[model samples]
Target chain A: MIKRASAFLLLAAIAIAAMPSAALAAEDGELDAIHHSANAYYLDFTPIGKLQLPRIFVVQHEDGSYGLELFRSTAAAILEGGWVAEIDHDGEEHAEGEEGHAEDGAQEAHAGEGEAQETGKYAGITLAQLEGHLVPPGGGHVVLDMSISKHLVFAWLGMIVVAFIMVRMAGKYKRGVGRDTAPKGLFQNLFETLILFIRDDVARPNLGAKTEKYLPYLLTVFFFILTCNLLGLVPFGATATSNLMVTTVLASFTFLLTQFGGTKDYWMHILWPPGIPAFVKPILMPVELLGIFTKPIALAIRLFANLTAGHLIILSLIGLIFSFANMFGPTVGYAVAPVSIAFALFIYCLELLVSFIQAYVFTMLSALFIGMAVVEHHHDHDEAHGEHHAEPTASVA
Target chain B: MTLFAASLLAPDLGLIVWIGLTFLILLVLLRKFAWGPITSALSEREDKIRESMEQAEKALAEAKQLQADNDKARREAEAQAQSILREAREEAERMRGEEVNKTRDQIQHLQEAAQTEIEREKQSALDSLRQEVADLAVSAAEKILRENLDADRQKKIVKDFLSDLPKN
Candidate 1:
């Protein structure tokens, strides 16, 4: 599985690198191809910056019929030249005005300075190139103007729809034993197995008889994390869990549960533990309190780091092919493309597995922590049984 | 970099809204549809197992009862066999006693008969002897009278003989 993931990651990297940069231009309308010479195609990367990025031209124009080249330079540059032409056209008027008065000449100099200041205000501001070259034979200009960010919006919508579908399928399984009899579907089997695992392995063992009361929270955490993790694997989807804010909020909830559910015994031990040396209590209390805060912090970082690392690795592998393509030519780029694409595909599949594992680990750990807080120590019972009860030590406050 | 920071810092209001709504709906659905039935089913299964165990215990008790009855029957049959044997022995003893008594009576009767016959024979013998002796004496006296004397003596002797015979 690991090898396959690596192979898929490599292949995906290569495929991403080999994709035509011009395709990106199709999304952004404010870019135009100004000139092409020999081996290099000079195209505006963004009209905001006249900085050129390398690209390939699929079609050419003749007689400047498309007229897209008109917006190539900034409006400021054109206006600067227009001022020179205006000065030449007004040469006769300027000589006539100079003969009228020396005071008038001083006023004209002030007016010219004011005009220069106005020109500077509008300097470097360019009109956006929102048009494209036309195709041959009874042609018209192609205008590329659409919201590029809409892709991310659609991706989020897709995630929600998929989540709904999964929830519905899980509901079907929950509805009847007949549906549960066949554990063939992915979501159904996953949900059923997770429910049983949490009930028997984590919740029952830790929470014991009262585990049923807390099963809903445990199940919710597991499915919620799983959904977010899986969503991150889809192409162009934002990783909500990869964001620190999301994980932190989740960890905070766990912290709240742990604190709220804590038994009197749990708090007592944290505050004034039995059988501890008199001098040590003061020092131990602070350390115990610090430990309490770190629990949620650790939960937050563990989830955030794991998810972010996976995404970074995928992104870096794809980036490697781009760097390689730039260093060499398309030939080496093409040759290595397959290897990187295969690796990316492999990584995507691995992410799917990681998604479930991370979710399970998070839920299990949360249950464990909550269990610790609420668990009855039974020190009194032990003492009554005529056995030597160990002194209860201070834990997280 | 600024755009990235802005995007990150921006509150995910959409997510919070969606998640809160989704969680509420899920909680309601789960409470309504899943929890009650699943728990009850598990409890029911446990009850069934316990019931079957109790049933098996009852069956075992009944089996033990039948075994005790069979033992009792065997004991009763043994006692009846002994009683029959005892009755047969008593009957044989009584028959033997009757047979002995009858044989003793028959022996006694035979002995008495033998003794009576012996006595009768003895008496008859004595009577016959007396008769024989009297006849012999008469023969001798007649011979002597003939020799002693003739007519006169014979008359006197006849008168005396008649008187002696009347007296005898």
Candidate 2:
């Protein structure tokens, strides 16, 4: 066990060391320069431009305000794209000829500039500039640039291979081979226990008879989210889930499924609920309808916020080491690094639990909503009201 | 606020495409391979656990039954031993009574023999005494007659006495 742990630690160290630290330093320097530039003072916020993708730039203003700006790359690309963009703060389109002239001048001036100068122009880019420019951010700029792309790919592939091995291990157990009778591999045991837990604890209780129908989706979501979350915890890995776009996409699927699978009773309950007074129905109907949309929205925001916050916290802690390093020199920086890394690691472990928890919460809520929608709702009426008109002959008899 | 608004307006077409494709593939694969067997295995495991519990319960009951049977057999053996001792004691008492009856009969026979012998002895002694008394009486009578009368008187008394005696 010690040997395996040490090996993993060593690999992690190598992976961390392999990050494009020089490149990140260069980007940070460029961003700092842009923040202090004369143009930065004029702009509302200094935008962090795409280090690689020229068209995609994050604009930053004078007061450190930021937004995304996307310049059209290819005309065909614009037609295929569906993102909404507005020029500057106003929701108006810049005349085509006017926008073209501005973009051409900026591109020509910066075309021959070195990497440092280019970074300066593009530093502190915000979400608005990305939208305005019609350029989507690469989802991995926070950790490293192109230099560490290979390592990121390696990690992603490694996760896939791990997942495949786990599934194979589960398959071996399912073939009537008991734990002792079969090859007791580590992957097999872990995967088996996890699968059993999901089946018994999550799927069975929530989905019931139809659990089998939904198991695959639940397991996939669980493992995929878990893998992504754990990988983010790695020293140099980019947190995919931290990006709102990624989590938004995931939540949208659940939303769509819930909406499409909603039964008539689900609609009835939302539109005209039982038991409310006639006067209160109007007030409650809107609230009930809003709940239907808000549920999925909450699911999306909760996951995105939790994951992004974890990343920000870790980065801030690491930034502390750098800030202290400047004040106290390299010795203090190196000394503080281990402590920061330790805290980061502690948070990373917590993230692992959160990853599982979030996946469970998402799947469980989906099942509950689906279950509620699919099941029938029974309404009880007052028997006294019905019996009020009963025949008076009964009293005579 | 614009970023937030634009984000909401964003169609996310690429994301939707990728997600839909991935979800479809996952759904198919899971339905084909994962769900059925996993549920069955879980149910099977539950059944096995319950069955083992039942078997354990039955074994415990059997053990208790065997213990009770052994206790009953031990009790029966103890009872048999006590009855055998009682029979042996009764036989011993019966033998003792027979021995006592035999001794009593022997004592009675001895008493009868003793009584007969004493009676015979008593009769003999009486006969002897009577004979002696008779001899003494005759002698006394002769002496008295010889001293009191001459030879002819003595002869006349003797002849009278002899004739009286012959009549007794």
Candidate 3:
């Protein structure tokens, strides 16, 4: 009884502890959930604080010459890099008036210049405004804003972690640990299970003799996506796979491999389609070509949407407590916390399943696409397209 | 909220480049350090297992063959031993029969020689008796002639002589 009571108290304490951040977000008048899941210029280690990431921008100067700007942090960008955070209510004309004022008082109030910086046109633009859109000096706009974000850092971390474990496992194999004998340690056995699963189940069935050729890529994709997906569930960690761009690139790799590795039969099936009538051949060509792109596009969107939606759901469930509090009182918030957290916990568990499932789905689809592209089915159309088959038979005779 | 919503689906170029570059590097590095060795080792282990299994099966078959050969040799040795014992028994029976026949013939020859010796001795004894009887008769006749007695006296003498001579 005592132990159970203590566990319940602990749960309640954790629930209550998480509410302050919710309250803080409510005070700031923003949906903390959206803010949490959105891409940001800094890492939000809530309760500890945000760590600002460095920003890099390619800017065009007024003289029509291009220049690159670098900042150690977003704060440094605002303070030292002659940039300022744009005010929410300020329009362009108001910003222009402030730019003139900033030009006048450039040297005097440079230190305490919290309102705007001395930069002429982009004086009033804030860090939020300059997030993906950093305007340049002297009427020149930003050619490219190549700032590092939280997702990128997390992505690199995931990569490093996966690489470290795999390389260490590989070292054991090289030393004849798993090679000569059974896999000894936890890491070796665990990795071997997953690796073999990918080889036998995923790659071999789809890739056939080409399994070895594509095993590395399949294994890499599986572990990398799995690690990234799991990283999102970690506290203060972001899901890199949740990013559309990340999935897009991954899917595009599959796209490139599929196209390049395509066999002659694959092209023939798409272009000429031996079984199809002459009238339908042209129509089928466009559809087949479109299918080539849609496959990868669907791959990207499915992974991105699944991760994002899962995170959004959990975040929303947690946000419910704050929404109730803002609408009613702290009492109401406290009342709703348990139910909100219970549901969030449930969804969080579901998200764990979703993470694995999404990774597997992506890799499976990729393999399937590649498998379809390289499939050699000489006899598939023999029965269905007997007209074509009869002509070939007659020619042979 | 709308801005954030838009940003959610927005594809960031920097992120794209980072993901592309880093993923490629990861793929290359993992292929070198991890996948290559791991897969080769797995296949190597599988091959070793299969080879050992095949060797075990071969050894088992060899053992069975040796057992079968030993059984055949033992049966052949037993049959040879039985045949030798039967031959020895037949030879003993034939020799015993020959010995019995020879002993019986020797006994018959000894009996025949004894019979011939007995016949010869009987004949010789008869001849000697006959000669002795003839001499006695001649002496008795002379004695009777020399005495020249009457007929009655001669008759008594002959009777008396005959009674005294042989009690025959």
**DockQ preference between candidates 1 and 2, better one:** 2
Give lDDT tens digits, candidate 2, residues A1-397: 9998997687556434422231143222211111111010111111333323223334453445565444433222233333333335333223212333334334432332334344433433332333343333332121111111211232344346545654565476587654324336676567667777776787776557766666666666666666666665554345545445456666776677667767786677678765557787788899978977777777777776776666556555556565566557879878987887677656655676787787677666666655555544443533332242122113212
If you superpose only chain B onto the true chain B, what TM-score does each candidate give?
A: 0.46, 0.51, 0.61
Against the true structure, whose TM-score is highest?
3
Question: Candidate 3 — which pairs collide?
Answer: A85-A126, A86-A124, A86-A125, A86-A126
Lowest lDDT block of 10, candidate 1 chain A: A30-39
True interface contacts reproduced, per candidate = 0.02, 0.12, 0.71
In what order do the candidates fall by lDDT, top score first?
A: 3, 2, 1
lDDT per residue for candidate 1 within A243-355, as digits (tens), equals 55566767777788889999997687678655667798788888877867788888877887777666656654554454455458657766775776667656756776788
Sort every candidate by TM-score, greatest first.
Answer: 3, 2, 1
Best by lDDT: 3
lDDT of 1 at A218: 75
The digit string of per-residue lDDT tens for model 3 on A13-52 reads: 6444544543343322223465567777777654455567
Indicate the residue-level lDDT of A158 in model 1: 38
Per-residue lDDT of model 3, residues B1-168, tens digit only: 445566688767877888899999999999998899989999999999999999999999999999999999999999999999999999999888998998889899889989898898888888888888888888789879966679988888888888888665
On lDDT, who's better, 2 or 3? 3
